[model samples]
Target: MFLTIIVCGMVVALSAIRANCHQNPSVCLQAACPESWIGFQRKCFYFSDDTKNWTSSQRFCDSQDAALAQVESFQELNFLLRYKGPSDHWIGLSREQGQPWKWINGTEWTRQFPILGAGEYAYLNDKGASSARYYTERKWICSKPDTYVQMVQQSPN
Candidate 1:
């Protein structure tokens, strides 16, 4: 009976440890990002290998509980430009038919970076961000908030 109890307790502990590590790979830090995600500043960014059109890419990100990455800072933009390699990847910018271009988060396009091609959807390549048809298929980057980092930082010290 004692051996059985010990085995059950060990199983529970092991499960808990697996859950923690699986959820966040770097638990020693406040906001550890999951596997395959890049943790930068307070955000987690994921670059996908599969190709999809602008709309499909956003839907894919939504399914992953994230959004197409929004470039808020020059540093973030540079990181993307440098790491994206050769293939062009769809970003979160698109026009609403007759309306002007905007980020996926609903911010107006302020032209922080020059867009090269002409189209309804924007993507990133070695030359920089460009716009192309919405149907143009490409890999994509997704962004989400680091799950636990902010909570610990905001909690009462």
Candidate 2:
């Protein structure tokens, strides 16, 4: 009888430990960003303090250990929009030199929130367009930071 009780207690303790460890990887542990950026989709994205060209903004994301955000859905697009400040910023998508729109991740377009004109790929802040071909710069989203996961066991008793 005593042996059965010990085993049952062990099972309950193990279950609790497992539950705590199985946390969502995308959820950030820290409240404030280590940099000026914010966390989204398990990555940190920054709006530049200075207005940088498309190339420079990409470099900034790279230096911070995150790729530029690829907009795949309206939910993802809206997630970025909520965090946007007054000034517009660049995201990862752009038109090829020949004017073909493509995601920086190289994935074929699966979903598009606001499809642009043939020559239009990059996004801008302002909702209204003077022409169908151009858009104002808008807010950007990024993936979570990469970190090693280590499980620390705690004593329940």
Candidate 3:
């Protein structure tokens, strides 16, 4: 009878450990970001309320371990459009007057959206349309990949 109780207790303890590992953040695997940042499709984004020139905005994002947000698909583009405030916002697209537009991450601009002008930097206008200009001060969005996020192990409460 003692042996039976011992075996049952061992089983219960093992079961509890497994459950804790699965439910506790200390042992679980997940992706996360800093407060106020939004996560989508394995990426984290920050929409800034402060307006800055294109170059300054890009530098700010870089300081946060991210780059200016790059819209790679129509779905993502639409998502930004919907959430963007009334004012135009800076994106990662930029180029010289006659050069091909490129993202800050070194990717060529996708043709998913029409370029409204031959400006140096691209932004979403107040009407939810994309336009390019060099010196406009606008709010900006920053994005970082999941791999850049720090994985923390939390102690179970």
Count clashing residue pairs in model 2.
8
Encode model 2's per-residue lDDT on 68-126: one tens digit a residue: 66765576577666665555556666665565466677765554656544544464354
- Give the 10-residue window scoring lowest on summed lDDT in candidate 2: 146-155
Model 1's lDDT to the true fold?
0.78
Stretches of candidate 3 exceeding 4 Å from the true structure: 1-31, 147-157
Pairs that collide in candidate 1 are: none
For candidate 2, what is the TM-score? 0.56
Q: What is the lDDT of residue 151 in candidate 1?
A: 36
lDDT values, one for every candidate? 0.78, 0.50, 0.71
lDDT of 3 by residue, 32-86 (tens): 6667888776578889999998889999999999998999778888878777767
Q: Per-residue lDDT for 34-139 in model 1, tens only? A: 6898888768888989999989999999997889988887898999998888999998988866788888989998878888866888999998899899888999
Model 2 stretches astray by more than 4 angstroms: 1-33, 97-99, 117-121, 128-157
Pairs of colliding residues, candidate 3? none
Pitting candidate 2 against candidate 3, the one with the higher lDDT is 3
**Which model is ahead, 1 or 3, in terms of lDDT?**
1
Clashing pairs in 2: 42-143, 42-144, 43-143, 43-144, 124-136, 124-137, 125-136, 125-137
